[model samples]
Target: MFTEEPSYDVLKTENAFLRARVQELERALEACVPRESAEEQHHVPYRKIFDALPVSLGVYRRDGLSVAMNTTSLELIGGIGDEIIGKFNILEDPSSISAGFVENFQRAAALGKNVTMPPCAYETAGSTLATIDERTVWTETTYVPIKGDAGIEFLVECNIDVTERQKTQKALEEKHALLQALIDNAPMSIFANNLEDRTILVNQRCADAMRLPPEAILGKTPRDLLPEDRAEEYLREDRQVLEKGSGIEWESERVRDGKPYHILMTKFPLRETNGKVYGVCGISMDITQRRRAEADNRRLQEEIIRMQEESLRALSTPLIPIAEGVVVMPLIGSVNGTRAQQVMEALLEGVSRHRASIAILDVTGVTFVDRQVADALIRAAQAVSLLGSNVVLTGVRPEMARTLVEIGADLHGIVVHSTLQSAIQYALMY
Candidate 1:
């Protein structure tokens, strides 16, 4: 298996630590086995450090005879190394050559120095190295060439297990790729800025919105990409979001493809695992069509309101020229303050336009007579009188007469007729 290079310093530190601990153990072992046989002393090297090491280790000759392995090495290989350590020869073993581990060992011996190998996974097959797992065992190994006056001597193979770390790294990489894909394919413009207000991430829509490539936008501040005024507005919003640790929504306008667009923007703070607000993220949606539709609707609504007002004005004070020097205005529905004012203006204008001696206000269609309605009638009549026109009130219902009197409406100068026919005859005669 091929993997990223392991740290060189870590391997060297492991070797140095092992050597120091081995020296201490070798002193103690030498004291215990004094006056032993040459054969017994010959086995001293492996016995000196096997019990003291926590790392998997093996001592191999340059020609590739495995001299010894520690207790940890036996445990690392799933308790199978004890049987093979003294018997296996890596340079001659078909499995070792096939696994290509022999090349690294031979390289270390030729250089007469230590070499740190990249991480590798080994199968627990009929190979010289047996590791316990239903899956391949991942490890990083460093080969140290021990030299003597006779030239290169033994090779120390140190192995560090990295199965769990490799799995964690792979999982994180997959998740990152998934997240990137999601953002890149999103419809709305999405972006994130770091603490320095530099663009850290921008999705496909964001790049397209700016009419720039992703590489052109990344790592650049808004000022670099947009006009100063617009960039400052964006920066200010970002600063506020980061400071408040909250979100804000607002509408703004921009031009794209030579056309103006209204966009609704939402900006929020991005938090780290520790709950610290590290940056701001934003998404902008183009609402150009919606804004245009709303504007059109407003214009339509205003036109409708204007048309209704004109119709009401016409109905409120309809001036009919019954004959020369006569005009009749029919007051229908309820008369409010605004309609009353219109009534007075219409009557005076009608009197002048027809050169009439009298103006008749027919209240036959009036639904109810209140103090306000009576007052409006009185005020309108008084105003028309000033224009040298007499306002003759027709359709004077008994209830309206009571209301007019109770409200103290002074109708001294104005003529009151019970019917429009009588009012018209009276106006022509006057």
Candidate 2:
């Protein structure tokens, strides 16, 4: 009976499985070997099995000369000959010496223990001659010292390339440092507090605002340093953030030295990598100066309004000297109690200042007159009379006279005229 040879696919699958098993053993060996223990002796056939595996491995005598090396190790040395197999000394190699591998191997041999160094730069002559890849390579190397019955026998060296991983880790560290610098020097007050109410982080502005040094602020709760009310308020807001699991923006107030300072504050929930809420992060900016500016603007507006009203009141009740001894007061717009009082005061003041004997009040421009205005006019007439000047009412329409009668305003001693021209003629003739 003839047996069929193994299929190519089956042989390929077997080869792959063997390779995976060898890699697994490599990792297991790395873990099982204690760092402080000398390596136990292995059977001679085991070295040939390790040589068949696809990794760089070699055994070196205590004197640093190569005793045995795998095919992969021979390939890494750039050639296979007496110069590589037995004469190769990693300690004497210029590349290994410069790359720190030689020192690590020496240390392992001296201690009679295993030494592992990760992400170190090591380049082999074979790799440099073969490829156009990076001149510098990164690796995680392991050195294991083998001991025999007599003393130290050999040192096993293993290497694993990790160039990409090292580069990625370096980039992440650089980015984290940049981000930390930005937050540390930010302009606004910023803080992060854990659920236990302990301060985890604070920026320069936050320290300045609290009037405390950074060393004193970190790792402490707000209640430890801030005022009672303020600390309570911060805790309350933090609780809100935790409950909502989201961000909130609001304006708040802080009192210092009996003065109120306004602040715009933003708070949000901080979460862990697993998406669980852990704490609250907050940022605040002082808006006291902005609010003060708004208040000042309001006061300025009120002042402008007051000035405008005064100007209009003066225009509405102008007292003009029409003749040598006669003065005319023209009343316009709807007359109110306040304007009537002003009218009385202005008439008296004009009489005293201009020294006019006759005062004529023209009400033609006045649209409406109330009882308060009629009383005010009578009072103004009485006041002018007391100043030794006579008051004549002119341009009194029929409607105004009816309104005066209806209001029971007694115009007993006051002389009346139908027009301002008639009043002027009467005052000049008198």
lDDT tens readout by residue for model 2, 299-396: 99999999998888779789999878789998877889889988998898888888999999999888888767777888889888988888899888
lDDT tens digits by residue: candidate 1, 288-381: 8899999999999999999998787877789999877778899888877788878877887788888877788899988886788689889888
| Cand. 2 Cα-lDDT | 0.85
- State, as a TM-score between 0 and 1, how close model 2 is to the true structure: 0.64
lDDT of each: 0.85, 0.85
Alpha-carbon deviation at 87 in model 1, angstroms? 4.2
Using TM-score, give the best candidate's number: 2
